[model samples]
Target: MKHADIKMAAEALFNERHNPLGAFSLGSETHRAVTIPDAVRRCRWIAVDINASAFGLFFVSPSPERARLVPCFDSDYPGVAVSTKFISGSNGEEMVHHTRDSTEPRWWTDDGSAAMNAMFGKLAWTGPMAPLAPGTSGIAFPVHADRGQCGLVVFTGSEIILKQDLLYEVHARCFSLFAAVARIRPSDAGRAHTISKRELECLKLTANGHTSEQIARTLKLSVHTANQYLTQSTQKLNAVNRNQAVAKALRLGLID
Candidate 1:
């Protein structure tokens, strides 16, 4: 799809008011979610510009991947940059079963089951359908051919391939916005805002739908301490609440 057309469609669909087709839109800016629950509901699987270290979010305007409805803050997040790789075990790289012609995202279906199980153990969820296919999945695209950082905006779920070029452009742009919003958040600082590993442990449990008291019991810590850890973690992430903290933490690679 032409870039101009993609932008217009994205703007229309991402409005807070439901469009005629009633597709879900999480506002024009992704960071507006500000809470883990909101973020998760919007995109079940998300990672921000992953690398060996560091993590961050943002939004792309017009395309629904970056800006609009973004809170007035001094932060500058990332853009929708992508680096899609071709899988081929022949190159001493991991390979997957996919059609070479398609630019859509791919996941490990029954095709890569053995290797996936060896790497991650058996996944418990049946995904969106029955009889689970286990393994890892992510979206990648070869945008930005030459200069600059690969504008990475990472989010994943059971995304079916939309063969239309315009739709693909829309999908990619929306993710770019998600990344930008994240990148702009304040980076972790020294001691005062550093999130503890234990706190992170608690945060993951909480993300798994656990209550504060349950997390405390599971960790064998006082309820007050459990709550305190959550509060501190939330503050460290600059999140409005524990849920946002969890979402931010997840995006930041602070938790699984």
Candidate 2:
């Protein structure tokens, strides 16, 4: 697809109005059903559209003193470590470095020297996908959010490639997905707002499709007390009922 076309599709996917093509949209149901997992599942199309064989999302903390990264999600590649070393590793350092240092999109390939010096072969994108060694060709898109939060969405394939224009546009889509997920999963500080441990447990059970009685049995609480906890949590979250409360709590990262 053209860069402009991809941009429009991304915007449509996150628009507030319900989109008829539910498969392509995250805002189709007023965002009530939106969750971090759901967002990741829906955005997998990025890799699919580009024919990438591997896809991964990493949340990055770019503090020079303690640069760290956490894998938020991945697909098409199992048992692969998308850890801090993966980002700072030789073949990857330049791509991720450009991202963290300048917040730019980068494409990379191992030059055979990476395996030798571990840092000598680090190079910038010079053209379309070149004949790359296995496990070395990929595009990294930097996503910067408020409060110094940032992430990298990486797409890799045996012979994957990207044009300069498409690189920027695809990065925009990555940013949109990241922003949507951040809104759904609030910061840890926000977790302290309300909802006691017991209340959260009840809500989590409710989210797992358990009945109040079942939750009571599992937690060894009276059905009345279990119901009360659910009610209090629902009220505190400003939700209309247990189900809505569970949804809100999930969005707020209060419950898994």
Candidate 3:
């Protein structure tokens, strides 16, 4: 697909967040697990686990149909943890309490004030849903436990409000599944690749079949610089070539 096509696809996906290509019983361990084939035909699923000090990517949907959310990233990237920080980083406001106390999930968007926008806007993201970190729209469902330790946070790209009745089942089940496996007060999540913001944008466009020159025009960067981003992303993803990098990025939930 082309860049513009991908953008339109994302808008459609966002609008249709409550409607899946397939139906589900809404009684599954995770939101994505509720579906037999895939939850959202065009979207990918990511699980975020929170602990005492840091957050990490617990799972990325292995669906072949789901596109990479970003071009050169996965759970192994440091920015994943940073995203959590941005969400829970409010002054004197602990994150766990936000989930432990509330039964309902809360909605968040990166399209807030300039400060909020800059916080999530800088990270690497791609795909039709490539609303990058500083600006990705999602709902946070916190996992509460009686243990009084850290709570888990399950962040999904889906707006999730439209199907509140149905999606709540999936979200509650996700909490149980996450609580069971989560470590109490664990150490930091391991190292992840660090790709620049511009590199990610370039890689996403490139994945949409834009050549160096086309990417340069769209992004208003020089062709040489556009190619440079691809090369850098290729190196960071440790892929043999740009094609391999795209595939790896998708599997890693970096691009879509």
Please estimate how well model 2 matches the true structure, expressed as its whole-model Cα lDDT.
Answer: 0.57
Q: Could you give me the TM-score of model 3 versus the true structure? A: 0.32
Worst lDDT run of 10 residues, candidate 1, spans 83-92
Local distance difference test scores for all models: 0.39, 0.57, 0.42
Full-model lDDT, candidate 3 = 0.42
How do the candidates rank by lDDT, highest first? 2, 3, 1
Which of the two candidates, 1 or 2, achieves a greater TM-score against the reference? Answer: 2
Q: Where does candidate 2 have its weakest 10-residue lDDT segment?
A: 116-125
- What is the Cα-based lDDT of residue 254 in candidate 2? 56
Residue 167 Cα positional deviation in candidate 1, in Å, after optimal superposition: 33
Can you tell me which runs of candidate 1 are displaced by over 4 Å?
Answer: 1-183, 186-193
Candidate 1 Cα lDDT to native: 0.39
- Output the number of the TM-score-best candidate: 2
Candidate RMSDs in order: 16.0, 11.5, 17.6
Instruction: Report the backbone clash tally of model 1.
Output: 28
